[model samples]
Target: MNSGTKQHPWSRYVALGDSFTEGIGDPEPASLGGYRGWADRIAEVLSAGTDDFAYANLAVRGKVLRQIVDEQIEPVLSLRPNLITISAGGNDVIRPRSDPDEVAVRCEAAIERLKRDNATIVLFTGPDLGFSPVFRGVRGRIAIYNENLRAIAVRQECVVADLWALTEIQDPRMWAPDRLHLNALGHHAVARSVLSALNVANVLQAYDPEPMPDGTWRGARTDDLVWARTYLAPWLLRRARRQSSGDNLLPKRPTALSLNGPRA
Candidate 1:
């Protein structure tokens, strides 16, 4: 499939945020940083017909809004990209006692600084987690944050990749085994949304994950117990210790360079 007639205006693009932008769950060992995330997917589509198109991703995992503003802004400014996508505040929003409004304020500050060069900025809303057995408890908080992000997009004159409205992601199949980050299917869904938000046409297709076999109630409970022990318990321990999964990790693709991937 080919891209649509709408020609995108950007030649240089940069991505900034946490694990969602970093491609945490979609492991591609051959790709830079060993992941082909939504940003990378977008870069591929945007670079399809243009040799001059260049991209950079400065997103590290486990970064809060303030950390993103502090750590990523300088590198992005240095890139001087014409297009930028940022998905911050998710980490903050999920933390205990964190205020969504405050997170939005920090996000606005970041956007204010980023748009100084008149770049087309794109912001992402956190997904609706109403279907997640683990994260459903925080659904209301995420909704508030999404509203804040929508308002920020309007005031900042930026585009919004409204993940909160993408109903396809509400399924557990769209999530990674850890249930925090997106799997490949979820990342692809996000890439498609980003392109739509930019009004860029692409050939990416909707994918349906293989259906899970039905399980007995006891089996499901046992699975949950195993998940808690393997993935959840360690995560809680890290939070207790004030540690992060991305501690000391560097950006996968820090420089803006032409992408090489399967064309649309």
Candidate 2:
């Protein structure tokens, strides 16, 4: 490699985390996982800049921080890519039974290893979960996790793609009907932010926000009943059974490949 050559934030990029990194709500027809997320979106933009640009997404839909570190740490360290982003821990701390301190400790350990690589590591805090009445109780835990994440980023010298301060993330329309994952627009907002943080060229050009909801609470109780019956009940059953959304699923894009190339 030429020492004087400029790098474009990433030539080899990798993403790691949970559902948010996996693109749960943003539908994709070609991939079996059925979604294309911020990582993919950023990869596409990078691909436009250089044919050498490649990307890998190892994020599954439901892994917690420790699991993510266990599954991803060695592979990512081996890959030694120039860029990486991790968006985990939400699945762990969102539950009433989980410990925020433990999750943070696991995450800090993971970030320390990621920092050992020459690659730039980008980190995103889980957005405010309080907007959903169902997760209101866990807001304190999420807040604590966010604070820990911010401190960890500083210590690791990793770029923090801060989500907690994003004003519009609290809007009802920014989320999916399930109220746990982000909808299309919410994903777009995140992608934009992630790219901007990377100083990717013309990131603002990717702007396509989901419109805020009108009369979102026109029939609050009726909607709550539907939400509970449709999404909450199944989630509880999964927890009781010790199951996960990513169970039987695989990363949609597991190996680094150019955006215009086939997945490896």
Candidate 3:
């Protein structure tokens, strides 16, 4: 997907956050951690024509906002990247009784720390999930968080990849089977958005969704039952046990490296 040939100004880029940044839904067996997400795709474009460019991804699945700031921030400082993209707090906002305002405060603190080096920062607004069956209840909370991010980006003078406004994400075809994460198509759309926000030219193009399968009302209900039984139940159980998908996992790319060989 590294189609850009023009020289971009960024020499170093680092991605930070949770599953979304880690490229969970878009699996790649050849990639580190079996994922090649939007961050990796963007890296390919950014690395083009830049001989000294390096990229690192510190995102892990199931990481909360506090963990991301407390754990990943220090490593980012050490990397001293000229460009950074962070998408955190989605895991927090979805929790019961979680306060979007409080989450935003923590996020702003992280933003303040990252700004110290005067690097170009890109922030993401969570995608609108109102169209999702399982996540529709949390749509309001996500919206509030998205607004906070928009304000933070303006105040911090950071670039924004506004996923809330990315209408393509609302389509069910753009998501993975889990419904919580984006599929390959969704990740591609996000990569495009990030490139647009950064004003970097790339040859990435839009992809059409596969044709929807015909279904009856009973079939839809049956699918919902299967989804809940498979994904939702397990996720709830994990929360009850205070378990995480990233419990024993490490960052796919813990340090900046050349994007010259492999994909992720």
Instruction: Give the per-residue Cα lDDT of candidate 3 at 38.
Output: 92
Query: Which digits, one per residue and each the tens of the lDDT, describe model 1 over residues 8-50?
Result: 7899999999999999998989779999888898898888777
Better of 2 and 3 by lDDT: 3
- lDDT tens readout by residue for model 2, 1-264: 222222365688889888898888778787536787667777766666476887788898878777788888778777778899999888888776788888989888888788776689998887776667778888899889989998898888888888887756677777788888887777777777876777765433333653754664657678779999999899999988878988777777777777673221
Model 2 stretches with alpha carbons more than 4 Å out: 1-7, 203-221, 261-264
TM-score (all chains, Cα) for each model = 0.94, 0.88, 0.93
lDDT of 3 by residue, 11-58 (tens): 889999999999998988977779988999899888877778899999
lDDT by candidate, in order shown = 0.86, 0.77, 0.88
Judge candidate 3 at residue 6 and give its lDDT. Answer: 62
Which pairs of residues clash in candidate 3, taking residues 3 or more apart in a chain or in different chains?
A: none
Q: Residue 263's C-alpha lDDT in candidate 2?
A: 22
Error of 1 at 185 (Å): 0.6
